[model samples]
Target: MSLYSALYSGVSGLTAYSSALSAISDNITNVNTVGYKGTSTEFSTLVTESQTFARYSAGGVRAIPRTLVSRQGLLQSSSSPTDLSIDGAGFFVVRNSPSATAEGAVQFTRAGSFRPDAEGYLRNTSGNYLLGFPLQVDGSVTNTGNVTDLVPIRITELTGTAEATENIRIRANLQSSDPLIPSVVAGTYDVTNAANNVATGGVVPNFSRDIEVFDAQGGTHTLSVSFVKTATPNRWAVEVYAKPASDITTGAGLTAGQISRGTIAFNSDGSLDVANTTPALLDPLNIAWTNGASSSQISLNLGSDSNVDGLTQFDSVSTVISTSVDGAVFGNVTGVSIDRSGVVTTLFDNGLTRDVFKLPVATFQNPDGLTRLQGNAYGVSDFSGRYALVDAGTGGGGTISPSTLEASTVDLAAEFTNLITTQRAFSASTKVITTVDEILAELNQVI
Candidate 1:
């Protein structure tokens, strides 16, 4: 190769190195930036003729290319439920609504650091809505929808009278030895079904109880429950049958007949317990009786009970209790349940019911193939294929940790080393330019 060509090659090398230095510098600067991905340089030679050895400049600069592919660094756990980190593949989709235009509007992200917006929707620092399908009541995603289009996380107080509106769990031990026959005189073994509404007895002895309770609106509902005593020793099956109360004051037709009936076993101790049932229901409708309107009473008329040894008979039963049915009387959040699909639900002291939000997760055809969008976010691309919708901890997604967040994965020491290397390259490139100028000045002086 000619001397001039050799010189050009060196210059090109300097140019490429300088660009690489710049890219590395950029990476170092963002070392503390959450979800930032580092970039590297690439170079190739341009050969005019292979036969002419060293004839061409070390191929002028090839692309001082930015990397479109990178392995996401390991995730750091911030212990924040809202702080999310992708363990394997996929990106946290965020809508860049503020900066969006018709063309290439929504931007995806890797940063899981987010907070609730004023509207209670989860959004990133850029105010982008994280994308994913909203969970349905049945724990199913409706449209495989993206978050950018949906409303923010909803926040508001839910109100209602969580009365044993349906059926107050009835758990009580009817002693095996206790001679309690059905109400009728001739040892009523058979229970009479009146109006085809309440079932007297089947293979199992199941009964329904209707209680009149006022709602948050001071409206009464005729909550019915069906109880089934499974004949299983010390165990019974119970289910709730509920209907709004037509009226609460008059006990005329408000008998323990309208409630859907289920049976639960009472241990030998007479304490009602719902076994193998979640939230365990125990005792005569472990009635979580509430008066959403105000302190009220619902009758528990045993109607008639024939005792053992043919001795005792107890008829009428009734009681009054307070309710948290209105705003002034907010119910306490009680039990929190997560279904198999990771949908979180909160049971309140009040009777009102609701399914708050479904924990969402983004899955990719190839998680490793996802292109980093920085800020701990990833984007879908040809390499990423398509997104596979899923919920937390399912289909290779991470499980959610409520009240926690993920920390930054950046390592300060490693970033500093990279910074040093970039600085050296920058200096070397400047030296090359200086040397070139010096040589040109010498030639001009000699001429």
Candidate 2:
């Protein structure tokens, strides 16, 4: 009976070692796999009571395979813009379906080799869609960090719309040493009067500048501002013209050659006096376009009332320092990129960048307890606890390193060593079984 048990024990040993060999083989094969975790076989002894001796028993080994899921892997640099890796604790939230279909279960992974498909949804090698929080136009997260708030990041609809020019800020210096324009009377000057043209033996503007402004429909129009020195010290009369003054005829409302929009007055210090400015309340210039395009209201900010942050009058040559307008033409999506904060930015052909999505990193209380899944992914388990979906670099989640991938955690050298020892153990178990068989044959012959 004891000999029979010995044969069974040897068989169990052989099976245990075979399972260990299998685990070692798997580890060696996936050494280059991205985000791959290695597994090892854990052995335990099984015992049964013996009739003759109370403490004596027949025991055999059993193998339990466990994955080293928490082990960290080295990060490798990648050329792809969507490749991402976690430097610390977190997983990228993903889903199998692009449609938020209730049948599809959510998954987590560290294999961030992602690229947008034809539909602009970011998906990994396994075809799982990457999920994140949608960003508002102002670059703020739209929803709380909940599983339901996650959505597939799509950039195909990122073509920007045209924005009409509403505000224009001018920063320049007006020459203080310039002589007053001849034939220009202060407080009684009229921009439409024929006496104001120096070419026609009247007064002419000391300086003038023209800039292009866009209408609501993105049509370009030339707006010219002419400055004339008045009799009053440091005073200059500002007149806005839709075209050259020489081409316009003096008339009420608007004549065929009428080009004057309105006039503004500046103090001796070169700062705009808002109260005394025309269009009455320092209002925006309302241009009535003769072209087929609609009219445009443009606000001209010369300088602040309390500071010289805008236009200034100084004892220097008249020069245009800088001019900026808030507007952009319609453009198509050109490229996409991710930053350290995990914000996906879409670049447009109109030289504009928009934050389309904020990629959230999911972290667990016990990542090692997560259930291992196929394709280098993981699923939720009771031991792992609930996940905390947080912004990258916040709430214990690691910051994302764009264009990098995490390498497998398997060590080839260690796996080879394990292979040698498992092979020897398996051979020894076979020898035990053969020895038991030889003993049984001898006993049978003697009987």
Q: Please, what is the TM-score per model?
A: 0.57, 0.83
Off by over 4 Å in 1: 42-51, 54-56, 60-80, 98-104, 138-140, 143-152, 156-164, 171-353, 364-384, 393-409, 440-442
Error of 1 at 33 (Å): 3.2
Candidate 2 residue-wise lDDT, 5-53, digit = tens: 7788899999999999999998999998888888988899988777676
Total clashes in model 1, counting residue pairs 3 or more apart in sequence or in different chains: 65
Q: Looking at model 1, which ten-residue stretch has the lowest summed lDDT?
A: 307-316
lDDT (tens digit, per residue) of candidate 1 on 1-447: 343554565577667767776776676676666556666666677554556554444345553555543346655656445555555444555665433356335455556676656544567665666544445656555644454444334333233324423222222223343222233223332222332223322322333444454444434455544443333454433333334322222223323322223334343444333353323222233222234344333333221222122111122121122222222234555444434344545567754445665646666665556665534456678876776556667677655444423333445676577568756865765676677667777988997
lDDT of 1: 0.47
lDDT of each: 0.47, 0.77
